[model samples]
Target chain A: MNIQTKSQFVAVASITSELSAVMVVAKEISLAAANAKAIAFRAGDKAKGFQPITDFINELAKETIDLVTNINVYALSLYRLTVNEYRRTVAYNKFDLVVKTTEGVTYAQSMQAPLENAKISMQNCQRQFKRDVKQLLDQLEAVMHHARAARVIAANSRIEASQAGEYLQSLQAVAESVDKAAHTIHDNVQRCRIALSLYRNS
Target chain B: MKMTKIYEGSYQWIMFGRDANKPSNIIDSNQYAVRTANRCLLLEPGGSELFAPMMAAVLHHTPVDQITDLFASHQDPDVISSLGLWDQALSNAKLHAPAIWEGYLRHFGCESIEYVPIPDNGGTIKLDSVELQLIPAHYLHSPGNFHVYDHHAKILMSGDVGSAVEAPGAPMYVDNFDSHIEKMRYFHQRWMPSNQAKRAWIERVRNLDIDILAPQHGRVFKGDDVKRFLDWFDSLQVGIAV
Candidate 1:
């Protein structure tokens, strides 16, 4: 295998590793949202604003989890495509070598068809890989969008947490956890995007 | 790659080996092709490294499309690892390999070609008018191995039974039977894992009237050397590693 082909395989495989961390953090955010919702109920009128923010946090976490789950499946398919592409490329190169070796021999011209077919099969796999990478990048971008919205929700959660008297500390802790989870999700998804960006259809 | 025509009547049996450009690390192997009027069958098509030169050599005799059949003696890489490349090149070819090794051999890539599984007892591969018998040589080296014998041509394509580890550019046929004993002794003793299997295979092969014994590796044995190899192999104790 060539250096570029090796890199392409590594880049595709790394996305799965990075996104598993994002899945875990997204679930953590979901758990934090449940804790905040209970605290808001106990604070009654003081946490009225915080109750709705908790629902928004839960909704964002669910969306992020769902998006990451789908992207994981897509990443697995991309890895298979990389393997298929490598096989096609090897077959094509070997067929080309056969053509060169049989220069002056009789029936050498019969190899031209397989050679042409191999080239076309290899090119098709290359094009398919680029298209799939572009789609995966777009999906990663969606996860990034959710992470950004989560940070915004965390800020609103902090402002609402200040109003509750006795429940203030617990509510602030919930807000802190959400903010940390959002940062993790953002960083992991960003890494996935960066790794896959090289092979994008652009 | 050197090409030698061992048999020529209505159909031809051509042996390919002794590749001058083969890499130094891998052991050398011989590939045989049986060409009839409209079709060709490649026996022990060789490893992935030998695919290019082997194909180039075969193209001198037959085209890619007409190369319709492939046979693997066992699941060994040196025997049939080039299967994936052949699968892609020949769209309509059928691989006649051992029935027990169908799943294991598919790991080498066999999507396009149809796999004709040879039963434990043995089977026959008919290419147009010529009919070649698949003789069971199980546990000769591999547990589910086989050899090809042509009744009409009186040639037996032994898998590894009469094989020797010779140096590069070695002569195709065994020039002197007695001097060749040392070259084949260690390989057969170490690699052939069953004394019972060896005895059974020797007994079965003695029944056939073989004029030429073509092994996958090393030299070919013709005329009286065919009987000489069998006598030498019969007395030698194998499965010595245990």
Candidate 2:
């Protein structure tokens, strides 16, 4: 169960971890593309058309992974902000309880100023958390946009492979693999977007 | 941050360095903490860039409030630039540094800490029941440097005395002395000015029964390796300006 204070943070953290899994997929796609390129190089002129498709797939995987990793950095900021907010809230609550319980005491009268200051500090933390979360969501959306761009690149690679005729029968497998990995990255980022959207609404 | 226990007694001496997470742009530096039952003393706790992670690492061993004192070797940013953050975090903690660097280090934002100036010859810091000596390490590299020597633990926190420029995530202790020479050679020759100062430091330290020669940048020299380092350092000519 997600605590109300950390619900958005928990959601963002999960999205960040999910993005890590997508990076693994990207790495595998990169490896497969490299293998395909090696085979194309060995075939020489026979598989000349297939080499460019492999290069495109490899480039797409690298770009997707880089963008997702960048988004994870913003997610980390949200995590830190959330932790700070939780700490500030705890401090404020502790001071509030003390002020309420010690009403009419001289020390309590003096503590009121600091207690009000703590409240203001906590309010500021909440405001910062909201602002950072919005920024993180925008960054995550950008990552999703990049993932979609990778999918388009993959689609183009597949189209290029199909155009190679009988000479690039082996290239079709590599193209399909790139397409699958691209779909996985795009779909994973979409899921992360949905998760962040749920937190934003909540 | 990887922490290793060099000495174990009623008062323990722990070395905190070889941090893989530290920013690459900054030079790698070591942080040592001496922990007693009641109080803790952090020695040369590195720069402002490392304050958060280093404190997080320190919490693994001792509580923040228990950190009664902070000892900086000199006014180097890599040595105690994080003094300000530590000042804010550890209330009632006093900073024990060389008297010469007292005014200079105040620029690092040490407003809260009651700075106790160590004299030129050096002084003793008694944390509860443990007494550690702040031995004079004048200009091995820094102008006004002091190293911590835990008498009971037989561990000398020799700041930059046996420092090396090894890769991040290198082993904590020197396993092979011969191979480690290359790492420390250039560092000592270039950074350490004055061969006379080097000879003076070596002569002073020779009398101490240092089982573990822990430095601020690289690996700790334990057992026979301590003598090997001392002998090797004595032979090496320093302050050769090209």
Candidate 3:
């Protein structure tokens, strides 16, 4: 395999690794949302605004979790396609060598069909890989959107926690955890997008 | 790659080996092709490294589309690792390999070609008018191995039974059996894993009237050298590593 092909394999494989971390952080956000809801209930009227924010936080986490789960499956299929592409490329090169070596032979022209067919198969795999990467990028963009919305929810959470009196410390801690989890999800998804963007429609 | 016409009548048996451009690291192997009027069968089509030169040599006799059949003696990489390339090249070919090795050999990539699994007892591959017998040579080196024998051509394409390790550009046929003993002795003793399997294989091949004993590697044995190889192999103790 050449350097570019090796890089392509590594890029496709790294998607799964990066996304698993995103999944864990999203679940942590879900747990943080539940803890905030309990503190909001204890503060009663003081944390009324924070109760709705907790639901939003849980909803964003669920959506991010679902998106990452689907992307992981797509990434696995992309890896398989990469393997198929490599095999087809190798076959095409070897067939081309045969054509060159057998130039003066009697039945040399007969290899044209297989050669043409291999080239087409290899091209198909490349095109399919690019199309899949584009779709995966779009899905990752959706996760990034959820991460940004989460940051906004964390800011609103801090404002509401100031009015909760005795429950203020617990609510503020929940807000901080959500903000940190969102930042992690944002960074992990950004890495996946960067790694996959190279092959998209190229 | 050197091409030798070992048999010619209604059909032809051409051996391909001694590739001048082959990499130094890998062991050399021989590939054989049986070409009839309309169809061709490639026996022990060789490793992935030899695919290019082997295919180039084969085009001298038949076209890619007419290359309809492939046979693997066992699941060894040196024997049939080029299977993935062949699977892509020949759209209508059938691979006649051991029944036990279908799952294992598919790892080499065999999607397009039909796999004709040879049962443990043995089977036959009929290419147009010529019929070649798949003689069981299990545990010869691989647990599920076989050899091809042409009744009409009187040649046995032995998998590794009569094999030797000769240097590059070695002659196609064994010139002298006595001097060739040392080259084959260590390989057979170390690789062939069963004395009982060796005895059974010798007894089975003794019944066939073979004029030429062909192997996947090293030199071919013709005329009296065929019997001489059998006699030498019969007395030698194998599976010595245990």
Winner by lDDT? 3
Q: Compose the digit string of candidate 1's lDDT tens values, residues A179-201.
A: 99999988988888888887785
- The DockQ ranking, best first, is 3, 1, 2
The CAPRI class of candidate 1 is high
lDDT of 1 by residue, B149-191 (tens): 9989999999888899999999999999999999999999999
Number of the top-ranking candidate, with DockQ as the measure? 3
Over 4 Å off, model 2: A1-202
Q: Considering the two chains of model 2, state its CAPRI-style docking category.
A: incorrect
TM-score of chain B of 1: 0.99
Q: Backbone clashes per model, in order?
A: 0, 0, 0
- Give candidate 1's error at residue B163 in angstroms: 1.2
Q: Per-prediction DockQ, in order? A: 0.84, 0.01, 0.91
lDDT (Cα, tens digit) per residue for candidate 2, span B73-160: 8888999987766654555799999999889999876766899999999999998888899899898888898888877888999888
TM-scores across all candidates?
A: 0.97, 0.56, 0.98
Q: For model 3, how does the per-residue alpha-carbon lDDT over B122-152 read when each residue is reduced to its tens digit? A: 9999999899999999999998999999999
Compare candidates 1 and 2 on lDDT and give the better one.
1
Q: Give the TM-score of candidate 3.
A: 0.98
Q: Which pairs clash in model 2?
A: none
Q: Per lDDT, what order, best first?
A: 3, 1, 2
